[model samples]
Target: MTHRRKTLLRAIAPVAALTLALTACGSDDGDDSGDKKNDKSSSESSDTSGSDDGDDATDEPTEEAPANTGDLPLGQAASEEKEIKRGDGTLKAKITADKVDTGENADLTAAGFSADKVKGKYPVYAYFTYEITEQTGEISPGTDLNSTTAVLDAEGKPGSRFIAIGGQPLKGGCPEKDRELEWKKGTKATLCTTFLMDEGKEPTKLAYGMVNPLLWAVK
Candidate 1:
């Protein structure tokens, strides 16, 4: 009976040792799987943070007003010819600001402008030559070639007119024709427009069109 019991104890001991080894291996595998899941979660969190930073860079505003990038481009030089569709897109006019005259206070006073009106103002005379290159409708004399033309002051603002009344030729050759004549295609003419600049300031640019004006350097 003692020999039989000793053999049985040895067998049971080996079986218990095998069971303990298998449990230890299972615990190691569980630890490895948990570490892999933690690593994957950390990598996903880092990727999300990087993506949020890129979205902030593109939402900033600009410091200055954007330039005109429209149907008509800006900054054409004086004496360069440009064909623009005017008169409600009924006529295509070929136009150029041929000459610019400045420092005309005395001339303004002589040209029927009151002394009080001419005082404290620098005057400008801009002569433009234009022709109706093409027209789909009738053009009136009231639609003068100098319409939509302006002189920009040093501050990029349009200069005010010394005299607002139209239709009369001023004494110093700044003529305004107030006729009711009709114009046809291929008709050409020259006209003068005037502006009253601020005292002690010179005209910086001749501008065509009130909004996003096509600028010509006053040379």
Candidate 2:
């Protein structure tokens, strides 16, 4: 009876050991799989963070420079010769104090503007002569003169009280005329434009052009 019991015990011991070994091996494999999953998750998180940092580094702002005003004349006036180069053409422009007129003129009434409605100190008129010296296209002196012309006050600011009357008669300088006259190369014309000045606010200069490097009518 004792010998039979021992043989049975030995067989049961081997079977139990085999079962324990298999259980241990399964536990190790499960731990290794969990560790591999954790490593993959950590690597993915690191990659995502690095990509975000690279995006943030590229999203910054930059500053821009100011415009150049070196070629503009600040305070020039009439009777002085100014050589202004327009697109594809050059003009010899001149303004003269001798051609400037103010007060209640008969020509202003004849043109349709009432002297009674004149704002500012009084209505003033000036004559501009544009001689197209060199050109590759037709130039409209009247249109360019009206659009780009501005009178500067004594404070070096544009006069807000003035009304621009383009293409007025050269002799009377009143009754605004639409001078759409196109001058080809080597042509010249004397055009008149009127302005109304504020009381005691004398114009110090004239500025031309809607862009930088403006042609200034200096006093």
For each candidate in the order shown, give its overall lDDT on alpha carbons: 0.39, 0.32
Give the per-residue lDDT digits (tens) of candidate 2, residues 88-175.
Answer: 4444554322244454434333333334443233445544445554454334333333323334455543432222222133233333
* Candidate 1 wrong stretches, greater than 4 Å: 1-89, 164-171, 176-182
Q: Pick the candidate with the highest lDDT.
A: 1
Query: Worst lDDT window (10 residues) for model 1?
Result: 21-30
Give TM-scores for every candidate, taking all chains together and pairing residue i with residue i: 0.53, 0.41
Worst 10 residues of 2 by lDDT: 21-30
Candidate 1 lDDT, 19-47, residue by residue in tens: 11000001110012222211211001111
Query: Cα miss at 96, model 1 (Å)?
Result: 1.0
Candidate 2 wrongly placed segments (more than 4 Å): 1-99, 104-119, 137-144, 160-180, 212-219
Pairs in steric clash, model 1: none
